[model samples]
Target: MDIDAWLWWLIGAAVLGIALVITAMPELGMLAVGAVAAASVSGIFGGGAVLQVVVFAVVSTALIAVVRPVAKRQRTQRPQHATGIDALKGRQAVVLERVDGSGGRIKLAGEVWSARALDPGHAFEVGQEVDVVEIEGATAIVM
Candidate 1:
């Protein structure tokens, strides 16, 4: 039995799509789209093998050139807002108990948290407000 060029192109597109999903690579998806275009060229226009390959190469290259830079830029940009423990840092917390180098308790973000002073010599009294420097596991390092 003879297989048409379009059928082969479609098979190649399916393989490329599977590879894209397995590897999480956007480029493979682009190539798969190119393969689809090549299949269209062969099936709809009855184009020759050379023309189908040209269409595939042009589509793939164009997609990579145009989309890759935009994707890279977006990935490199930082989020506008912080979440989780990161948001807790730089926030003010009220000392519930005497907080010193060793340890103490504080009311942070409406919740009670184990806290300690940044400096061993520095201490915070009960009801006093302090800044959260960082979070170490379940404990908050304050100043």
Candidate 2:
């Protein structure tokens, strides 16, 4: 039985399209587009198998080369604002315990928190206002 080259390219395009839908990767979508281009070249343009493959390779590679870096750059960029515990930094807290560098507790952001002094040997007395310098796990580093 003889199978047409265009039929194979059509099948490849369909398989790649299905994979793109399932994976939700733009790269897979781009490859499926390349397969479709190859199918069109072979079926409509009556291109040889080698020419179809060259079109597929060039289109797929160009898409990856141009798009992947922009995607990577978007992923690597930092968010504009701090969130969660990061937002607690530099906020004021009321000392709930005699806070020393080793360990203590405080009322931070209206919640009770484990706290410690920013400087060793420095301490915060109860009822005194202190600033949260940073959060280390469950503990707040304060000054």
Candidate 3:
């Protein structure tokens, strides 16, 4: 009926491992690593329960504070290539309405889109093809 402190740390490590797998949380994995470190302190060094707990706390906090931000930054980095509406630029669209500097309509990417001529004096008649130059909000600037 006398369970060792190292045994408790091992049990905690196992539970934290399960939590990390089930939740897919990096923080839990960090804490689990800390638990293992604490187990080593309790067993290898014959450290007291308080010292084991202190090691666990310090290791876990350091991992969460230092590594988490780097992980998050790497995760949030933008792709090398453009996507979505940005990809529409430099592509071709068919003028559905008379397109002028003011306003018009076009068929782009199988959808109807509001359009404008890139040049102030330029105009595109219906059924003519124009190259998309840019997108400003919901409007496509074409030439």
TM-score, candidate 1, is: 0.73
Error of 1 at 41 (Å): 2.2
lDDT of each: 0.97, 0.90, 0.95
lDDT for model 2, please. Answer: 0.90
Q: Give candidates' CA RMSD values in order.
A: 3.1, 4.2, 4.7
Off by over 4 Å in 2: 1-7, 17-29, 40-54, 73-87, 125-129
Taking all chains together, each candidate's TM-score versus the true structure is 0.73, 0.61, 0.59
Q: Which residues of candidate 3, in runs, are more than 4 Å off?
A: 88-116, 123-132, 135-140
Report the poorest 10 consecutive residues by lDDT, candidate 2: 28-37
Could you give candidate 1's per-residue lDDT for residues 12-72 as a string of tens digits? 9999999999999999999999999999999999999999999999999999999999999
lDDT of 2 by residue, 1-143 (tens): 99978889888888988988888888987888788888889989999989999999998899889999999999999887888998899899999889998998899988999999999789999999999998999999999
Model 3, 117-140: lDDT tens per residue?
A: 999799999999999999999999
Can you list the residue pairs that collide in candidate 1?
none
What local lDDT score does residue 24 receive in model 1, on the 0 to 100 scale?
A: 98
